[model samples]
Target: MTVQSIAGPRFSWRGPSNGWRQREGRGPTLALALFILVFSLIPVGRLIVAAFEGGFGAFWQVLDAPDVWRATRNTLVVAFGSGSLALLIGVVFALILSVTTLRARTALAFIMVMSLMIAPQISALAFKTLAGPASPLLKLVGLAPAPGTPNPMLGEFGIIVVMGLHHAPLVAITLASGLASIPRPLIEAARLDGASPWQVVNRIMLPLLRPFLLSAALLAFVAGTGNFGIPALLGLPVGYVTLPTLLFRKLASFGPATIGDAAAISVLIALIAGTGVIAASLLLARSASRLETDHRIEPFWELGRWRPAVEAGVWGVIALTVLLPLASLLATSLVPAYGVRLSPSSLTLAQYVEVLFRQDLTVRAFRNSMLLAGGAALSLAVITLVSAYVLDRAKPKVKAFAFALIELPYAVPGIVLAIACILLFIKPLPLIGVSIYATPWIILFAYHARFFAIALKPVMAAMATLDDAVQEAAVCDGARLGQRLRHIVLPLVFPAVFAGMLMVFLLAFNELTVSALLWSAGTETLGVALLSLEDSGLGAEAAAVAVTATLLVLVLMLAMQMLARRLPPNALPWQALAGPDRERRG
Candidate 1:
C-alpha cells in the first residue's frame, strides 16, 4: 500500500463518539481555521469594501492622473528591466558553477546565496555608499561630480541593479537546481554526436529548463514590482517613484478619500501579483510530474590554458556584485563626515559611540525589532508545522482549498497587506474592539502574511520525505494525534522547522516597508529608524545604525549557517522520497 493508505483514516473520534468527540477533536483545528479566517480573510474583505465604497470615482481620478500614469509606467519598466537583468545574470552564474570546471565553484554558490540573506535596504545603502556622487573611486579617477550632482547611474538604473542583485541569488539557486535535474547521459549523447557547446545548450538544456526559468522570472517580477525599500531609498531621492512609494505618499496625507484611493491601488497590485502567482503555480505543477533526479556529474570541459581567465572572471563578478559594495559601506561608517577627503585623520569611532549612547531611539528600535522577530519566528513555526502536517499527512480529505488559501498571500506585497490590515481593523468590530493600527501586532501580522510561504515550503518539503509506514506503526500502537506529532513527526521535521524559523527571524528583524507604514511613535524598528535619520539629514547617524543592523544580521545569519551544518544532509525529505520512485522505474 502507498503511504497515504497505510496512514489510517483521515478523521477519527474517541469514546462515546456521538459526533461529540469528533466535534471536540476538531476544536483546535476549528479555532485555527477561525483565527486564519478573522486575521487573513477579514482584512482582505475590508480592503475590498474600502475599494468599492468610494464608488470607484476616486480610483478613476487617481488612475487618470498623469503622475499616476508616470508612476505606473515607471513601476512596470523597473520591474521588468530588473527581473530580466537578474535572470540573465543568474543564468550565467548558474551555468558556470553547475557545468564548468571553475575553481571555488562551491564558494561562488555560497556567496551568491548570501547576498539574499542581507535585506534589500541594507544592500541599497551599501551600493549608495559605493557608487554615490562622493564615492572614493570617482574621486580617485578625478571624475567626482559636483556636490549635489544628480547621478543617473545612482538613480533608477542603480535601484534596478541593486534590486536585481538582491534577488539574483534566489533565481540562480532555483535555476541551478533545475539545470542539475537534466540527465548527464543526454548531454554526453549530444556531445558524442559532435554537437557544439552552444548548440547543446540552445537546443537541449534550454528546452528542459523552460519551466523553472519561467517560474523564477514570474517570482522575480512580482518581487521587483511590489518591492518598496529599494525604490524608497534610491529612487525617492531622484523623484523616481513606483506604485508602493506613490501609495505611501497618498496615504501619509491621511485624508479619508485619499486613503480610499490608496486602498484601490493596493488592491490592484495584489490582484496583478496574485494572478501571476497562480499562473506560475499551475505551470510548475505541470512540470513537477516530469521532474526526476539525474545527479551524475558530467566530465568538465577542459578550458586548458584559458581556465585561469575563466576563474578570474567569476571571482571578479562576485567581488563587483557583493564585496565592493559592502566594503564601501563599512569604510563610510568610520569616516567623520560625508564627502570629506579620505585621510587617516578623518577616521573616527565618534559617530558610532554617539549613535549608540546619545540616541535612545536606537536602543528602542533594537528592542522592538527583537520582540517582533522573536514573536513572528515562534508563531510561524507552530503554524507552519500544523499546516504542513495537515496538508502532507492528511492529503485529499483536508480540503484542497487549504493549500490555495495558504498560497494566496504569496503574491500580495507587504505595503498592500499593511493597507489591508489598516482598512480592516481600524474600525471597531463586534467582539474585537480597538484598532490594530499603530500597534506592534500589525507588524507581526504583516510579517506572517509576507513570509508564510517561505516558512511553510521547507517544512512541507521535509514532511513529504518520511514514509507513511512510520506514522502508521505509531498509530497502530495507539499514539494519539498530539503524541504522533510530538514524538514521531516533530522530531523528524524539526530541522526544517528550525531552518525556517531562522529565516523568518532574519527577515522579520530586517523588515522595513510594512513596518514603515504601520509603526507609530515609540515603535520604531531599526529599518525605519535608519530611514528616518537619513531623511532628516543625519547621514552619519544613519550610517552608524546601518552598520549596527548589518552586523546583527550577519551574526544571526552565521548562527543559521552553523545550525544548517549540524542538521542532517537529507533534511529535504521530499527529494529523498521522490528519488526512490524514479529509481524503481529506471
Candidate 2:
C-alpha cells in the first residue's frame, strides 16, 4: 500500500511503470538526460579538465602553495566548529518546538527560518556593526567598544560564530522534517509505560532521528566549507582566509591571469566537499531507520508554570541572533557615515537615496539581480515541470544517474560551479562563436546550472503524488500524454511549481558566491554591489543595500508562508513551520 503520512499521503518518488515509458518513447527521456548532462555534468567535467590542463604538474602546483594549505586547514576547522554549533542549536530548538508547549512557537519558528534567508554577508555586516567600537546600536546605549580596540568579529572565531548562527536554521529545518516522521504510537506506548516526556525523547526519539541529525550536520558542514560571504566579511580583513575567500582574493587580484590557478583550487574544494558528502552518506546509510507512519510527532509536554520563562529564553535567543544584528544593520544604514554614532540628529537617508536612486551601479545591480533571478526562477519552473514528468517515467537506473547530475552542481561548492561555468564557457561557443565570458550571460548560465535542482525537487515530490489510476482513466478516455499533462497534472502540481520558483528566486536574488566570480561591468547583482560599497569604504551605503535586499527576502518569505498553507505537506523548505499547526488541526 502507498504510505500514509503525517501530512496526509506520503508520495513515493518511485518511477511509474515501464509501460508508461514505452508509450512516451525515448524522446522525452533522452531530452531530459541531454538537458541535465549539458547543464550540470558538462560544466563540472569541463572544470575538471581545466584543472588538469597542464597535467598533474599544475594541480600539484596549486596544492603546494602554503597559503592554499593554510586556507584548507582553516576551512576544515571552521566548518566542523560551526557545524557542531549549528547541530547543538538546531536540536535544542527542534526538540523544544516539537515536544514542549512553547508559547509563540509559530512566531518563533517563523523568525528562526526567516533568519536563514538573510544573506550571509548581510548577517556578517550586521553582527560586525553590532560589535564594533562605533556600533550605532551599542553607541546609542553608551556601550560601544572603545575606539582603537580591535573589533571582536574580525577573525576565525568570529567566522565560526557568525556562520554557526547563520546556518543553525538550516539545521532546524532538516531536524524538523525528521521530528515529524516519529510515529505517535511509539510515544504513546512510552507514555503508557510511565515514561516521562524527557524519557520518550532520550530513550526513543533521538535514536530514531540519528540519521537525520547526521544529514543535518553534513549539510551544515558543507555549507560552511562553501560559504564565501561570511569568511569574506569576517575572516578576510584579518588575513584569516578560508578557501572560498582565498579563491576570491586570487581572482580578484589577478583577474583572468589566475583563472588556471583558481580552477585547480576549485578542484581541490570540490574534492574536499565531495569527500564529506560521501562520508555523510555512509553514516546516514548505517543509521537509517524505517520511520514512516501516519502519525506525526506532536507536543507531549505542557509547560504550564515554566512557560513564561521558556518563552522569554527563546525570544532572548532570537533577539541576540537575529533582531539585534538586523537592528544594528538598520542603524548603520541610517547613519550619515560608517562609525558614526546613531542619533536622531545624526541619522540621514542619504545612503538609501544614493544607492537606490543616484548610483548608476547600484540601480543597475538591482535590475540585473532581478532579471537574473527572475529569469532563472521562471525558466527552471518550466524546465522542472517537464523534467519531473520525464524522470517520473524513466528507468530506475537512468533516473538515479540523472538525479545525481542534477544535484552535483548545487551540492558542491558554488565556487566550484562558478569555476566550472568559466571553464565551460570562457571561449566562444562552437556554433555561435560568441564568448559569454565577462558578461551577464555567464552569471545567468551559472544560476541555471546551480539552482536547477532547487527548482526540480519540490516539483518532483509533487509529481510523486499523482494518482496512476487517474492518469490511466484519462488515457482510457482518449487523452494523449500531452493532453493529460496539460489538463490534469499541471493544474494539480502548480502550487509546487510556484513554490519551487519562489525558492529559486529567493536564493538567486541575494546570492554572492556564484556572481563573485562571474559578474562583470554593468552586470553586477545586489550581492556584488553591496560588497563593492563595503570594499570602497561606503559602509553606510552597503548597509542600505543589505537592508533593501533583506526586506525583499522577508516579504517573499511571508508570501511563501501564506502560499505553503495550500501546498501539499513538505512541498516547500519551510514546511516544518506548518507541522505543529497541522497537528493542532488534526
Candidate 3:
C-alpha cells in the first residue's frame, strides 16, 4: 500500500521535459515544426524581406508616397471612428446583457454575433441595398431617394457605421470575458453600502475594466485597419481609400510589378497592428489588472421598472441594424434587378438559379470555395492533433513563440498574406520545380496559414485540461505513443478539435479579402464572385451569391450549435454569450 509498492519497481516518474520527448513525441514535434515553418513562418518572413529589398530605400519611398500617406491617414481615421462607435455600442450591449436584467440575452447576442459571422461584404451589400436611389426595398417603401442620388452607405460614414456594427460583437465578446471575471461580493458590498447600481459601475467596474476597454479598443482599431470587405464594397466606388483597399487596388490594377510596392504597404499595416498589440500587452502586463476572487459573478442590476423600455429599445436597434438590412438583402435577391421593385409579378428566382446552378464563374466559385474551405478545415484539424500534442510537452517559451507565429498569418491583414504568398510562390520550388502561385493550392495554403492558429487554440486548451496521470499511466503500461494518441488522446479532445475545424471552416468559407487578392481566372471563390457580380452591375445575382454563402454559414453554425451540447463549455463562443449564468466562471 506504500508508494513504492503502489508503483512497481520499473515505474519511473515522468515530467514534461523527460519521458514524453525522450520516448515518443519527436515525430509529432518534427511534423508540427515543419508545418509551422512552411505555413506560417515563411510567408511572414518573405513579406518583411520583400518590403526592405532595397535596405529600407523602397520601404521609406513607399511610406513617403502621397497615395501611401493618404491611405494611411484614411485608415487611421476610419479605424478611430469605427472603433469609437463599436466601443460605445459594444460596451452598452455587453453591460446590458452581462450585468442588467436584460431579457433575450441569448437571442440578442446571437443576432449581434451573427452580424459579424456573415461576411463583411455581405453586410455591406445588405446595407447598400437598403439605401440609395436604386434600392428595391426602399423603393417599395417609397423611401428611396430620387434618381441619380448617391448611396448614403458609400463613403466614410457608411463604412464607419457598417464596420462598427459588424465589429461591435468583437468588442462585446472581449469585454464579456472581463465582465465574467468580476467578483460578486464587490458588487454586493457596494450595494450594502447604499451605492446605486450606476454609481457602483462607474466607481468600481469601470476602473477594473480599463484593461479590457483598452484591449477592445485596440482590437477594433486593428480590425478596422485590416478590414477589406467593408471598404471594398462601401468606400472603393467612391474616392475613399484605406491601406488594405489601397494595397488591393494597386495589386489588382498594376499587375505583378506592384507586388513590391504592395509589400511595403503591407509592412506598414503590419507594423501598426503589431504596435497596438504590443502596447496593449505591455499595459496589461504592467498594470495591477488581476480581478480573480473566490466569489462568483452575479448580476445585481435589476431594471424593475425600465426593463420593458430597455427591451423595446434593444429590439428597435436590432430592427434597424439587423432585421431591416437582412430583409432588404433577401428582398433584393428575389427581385429581377437592383432597381426592380419587389412585387408579385416582379419577383423572380432567376438570380439564385443563375448564381447557384447556371453561371460558369459562379459554379466554379462555389466549387473552389467548398474545396478550399473543406480542405483547409480538414488539414488544420489533423495538423492540430499533432501540433497540440507537441506543444503540450514543449517548454513555455517555445510554445508561446509557436503560438505567436501561427497567429501572425491571421493577425497581419489578409492582403499582406496575399502579397507574401504571391512573393513566396511566384517562383517554383527549389527542388520540385512546381509552382502553386495562381492555383487553387495557393488559396488552400493561404487558408491553412490564416486559420491554423484558430484550429490549434481550442485543441491546445482542451489538451491542457486532460488528466496527465491517465496519459502517463498509458505510457507506463507500454501503450505505444501512437496507440495512446489514437485511443486515449483523440476521444477526449475530439470535440475541441472538431470545434476548431468548424470555426476554421466558418471563417474560411465566407472569407473574401485573402481570396480577392489571390484569386485568378477559374479560381474565384464565392466572395470574389459576389464582388464581381456586384461590380458588373448584376446586383440581384450578387445578392443571390451573398445569400447563398450566408445560408451555408448558418447551416454550419447550426451544426456547431447542436454539437455544442455535448462539448465543453465555451466550445462555441455563442454558447458562452448565450448563457453566461450556466456556471460559476473563473
lDDT of 2 by residue, 357-441 (tens): 9999899999999999999999988789889998876676777678878988998999889888888888898998999999998
Flag regions of model 1 displaced more than 4 Å: 1-24, 27-32, 56-58, 136-143, 146-148, 255-257, 294-300, 396-401, 565-586
380: Cα error in model 3, Å: 0.5
lDDT comparing candidate 3 with the true structure: 0.85
Predictions in order: lDDT:
0.72, 0.85, 0.85
- Cα lDDT tens digits for candidate 3, 442-542: 99999999999888888898887787678768766888878988999999999888889888988988899999988899899988999989889999999
Positional deviation of residue 533's Cα in model 1 after best superposition, in angstroms: 1.5
- CA RMSD per model (angstroms): 4.8, 4.0, 2.8
Q: Any residue pairs clashing in model 2, and if so which?
A: none
- Cα misplacement distance, residue 272 of candidate 3 (Å): 1.1
**Lowest-sum lDDT 10-residue window in model 2:** 4-13
Scored by TM-score, the top model is 3
Residue 139 lDDT (model 3): 84
